[model samples]
Target: MVAGTSTALGWLLVLLFSAVAWYLSGQRRAGNKRGKLPPGPTPLPLVGNLFHLDPREMHRSLEKLSKTYGPVYTIHLGSLPCVVLCGYQAVKEALVDQGDDFSDRGAFPVFYRFTQGNGIAFSNGEKWKVLRRFALHTLKNFGMGRSSLEPRIQEEAQCLAQEFQGKKGVPFNPIDLVCRAVSNVICVLVFGKRYDYEDADFLLLLDHFNENFRIMSSRWGELYNIFPRLMDFVPGPHHRIFHNFEKLRQFITEHVRRHQKHLDRNNPQDYIDHFLLRMEQEKQDPQSYFHMDTLVMSTHNLFFGGTETTSTTLRYGFLILMKYPEVAARVQQEIDRVVGPGRPPCLADRKAMPYTDAVVYEIQRFISILPMGLPRAVIRDTPFRGFLLPKGTNVIPLLSSVLSDPTRFKDPASFNPANFLDKEDAFQGNDAFVPFAPGKRICLGASLARMEIFLFLTTILQQFTLQPLVPPAEIDLTPLCTGLGNVPRPYEFRVLPR
Candidate 1:
């Protein structure tokens, strides 16, 4: 009996050693396959390249890595392999030529928790297609690109002017004013009305959304993506972020219910009304994706996308104008020559005021708010630039690299409007200038955003000359805190009346 027991123990030991050998052999084979990928910094086990990433200065860090690893490189964030496309050529190749293969957005854990694969931005497959199509159609019906919406934007712009006038030329942060104006534009489109700057509900919603944006771009947020199960148990900023998201969801849900009660099938006025009509139209279809949940999420996306992005861009526009007084003067001169103070500038005037138009384009290029344009996934095994991108691989298109490509722009680092102005003195559009991203998933609000930037900047420049309170050197152009967008540090300037 003792001899038999010893033999059995010996057999168990042999089996355990064989299993260990097989696992190590599999890891070695995976390592060999990874070796053929585009070059990048060597990663440590488990953590991969997590220690190398700095949440605050991620853009700068990525830019430096691009210098060493060529324009296309791969890095592992924990077990997930992320392929970074840098420079204009690399980004254009992945985002434009092969757009269909690379258009699927990678589902981040935190975003997935909030969005639940319902909204346009974070969704994929048939749901994303349906939501995106419905959103575009609904926005068009609500006068997005038509003349009907021009008056609404003008009204918001005028209200913004009045708010700034109330400042009495004192040095004050203009961020709030810009935020209110931009948010109201979406409010008019989504809810068919505008809110006063002091409205309690509006202010609360803004605070909640802003907090959510800030937290999503923080270190804690990154950690959550790495270790979701562990992070969920710990009380920290991620928990606060989830709380803010819940507040926003509740706010949107209330608005959606109100819209449903008052929706007019015959006269669908705003996005909510139009969506309600569509929901009824498709209610009988079992495969239909249009419903109250999606409507609420879509409205949430429109408000979040339309408000934060445009406002941040305009805020930076003013900061740039203040820093470069000469540029501001030239833009005002162009506006005066083409669009006098007697008339409010329209999108049509963009063609006439070439210099002013160039300045606006340059601001979008320089700011590059969405540095790492939303991550995309490979839906199927695909070949991207001679590299075998397996299905489910996450790809990141680096917008900062494209915006600041020295080969494309004359002086990419500096705020130079001449980059967009040709010898003929016309606003020259460059193929490399891709602020709204590219191809299929480009910003849905691109047309509206362009109009707002031109009209608002021209109107303000026509009325007042933006000047720094102190010397230009005193102005801080460095980004404040990296959020869902790049935000300028809070500063005050004197808006000298023209």
Candidate 2:
């Protein structure tokens, strides 16, 4: 009896130690271990704080979490550890000051499985350097940030205005019209020509892109990214994204075949022409990242970025104007005062039109599109402000936190253009206004997007005074959804000629 009792006590001690060790392992993953990393809400084993995350309003949820854990904190998605940087200071410190350390794109199962880390958006290190540099150079050469591209944007603005004019003051959903016009700009650059808005194939392609955006922004996408192995076999909308991506890939592949047939080495017409020329030039160089898959993926990246973000901003901008017609009136007044009523508004007019510029900035800030931003990864172990983020850990520079930092903005929650304006009514810019984000991974088309937004918004307001179907007070400015993209609620407005 004595021997048995002693053996039982020994086993009890061993079991107790094992349980304590297991608890410590979980704490380490949660960042709850003091001195190991920043503090955060404790995470459970395997799932790793999955229950704590709000799927739809992740940015808001994360913001709330920041309140509890402070600006820099860690949260686990499944087994993966992500260090989230909240507010302007934290994001600026990591992205701008320590750019090289946090330069790699974070791994997402969906993106990894689909893109295989091949494109500009997700590619890292040397591949990213080569592709991004070449893309910027080619885009600049083709008048992306130059005045040469102004005519193309002007043409599209005119076309878009014409489409709105056709509505004849009737309440209509302008999503398709805005999407087509904005997409054509990228189409012209990448494909060397723009298809008619009425074209079946063009609309079909847009639908595919739209569907992909919606799915990627849904909870299904988040779930797939977190628990990809299990989500793969699980029947749901998550699988549809793979289908959409494949279709897009097929379209790009088909385009590549046509581009090869009409290859022009001496004088390149567009992005496709430039890429093909580069591929040929580097055919003998085995070290070259220039290849067919890279071209296709890079082209897709340009298409995805160029279309979704800009077009959605326009879509959301119109919603904001309808929600606040007085703001729209002021913008129109500025456009008339600066550019006059006849000529199309140009990028040159942006400097002179302070009120209109403020409205544009305010719209972007209030919307805070892509709130969490495309996830970034630490290249190595990073000793952040009081936190030591491990190597290869996923980093989320909470862009919305910067855009709506209460310390910076007078009214962070409400839609107030004055947040971007001074007492003298001058367009006073805020360092926290990071719509295209900051750092080395800043949107490649920042200049282009800025020019597009300014020109498009001013031009539209120049020709039409937006009138909401219902009272402006009734229209909601809150985003329709908030997963991957902070999209505006679908609302219709009639365009009245100014």
- Evaluated with lDDT, which candidate comes out highest? 2
**lDDT value, residue 268 of candidate 2:** 79
Model 1 per-residue lDDT tens digits across residues 1-498: 999999678545434443453354333213224324566888765545765777676667778898888899887765567788999999888888888888898747777787888788888987998899988988887888777788888878888887877877888888777888889998988888899999988988888776766676666676666445445765787898788878888988888888878887788778888888888989999888888778878888899999888988999999988888888888888888888879788877877888888999999999888887778886777787767787767777888889999999998989999899899888899988888899789999988898888878888888887767788877878787663467677788877677
**For every model shown, what is its TM-score relative to the native structure?**
0.90, 0.92
Indicate the worst ten consecutive residues by lDDT in candidate 2. Answer: 26-35
Q: Best candidate, TM-score-wise?
A: 2
For residues 1-498, what per-residue lDDT tens digits would candidate 2 score against the true structure?
A: 999999679545534443454454443233323335667888766666766887778888899999999999988876677888999999999999999999999877787887888989989999999899999998898889889999999999999999999998889998888999999998888898987989998888888888878877887787777667666666888898889889889998899989899887777789988988888889999999999989989999999899989999999999888888788888888888888976889888877888888999999999999899989987777788967777777888899999989999987989899997899998899999999989999999888888888888888989998888888788887776777788777777789997
Number of clashes in every candidate structure? Answer: 0, 0
Residue 455 local lDDT, model 2 = 81
TM-score of candidate 1 on Cα atoms, chains taken together: 0.90
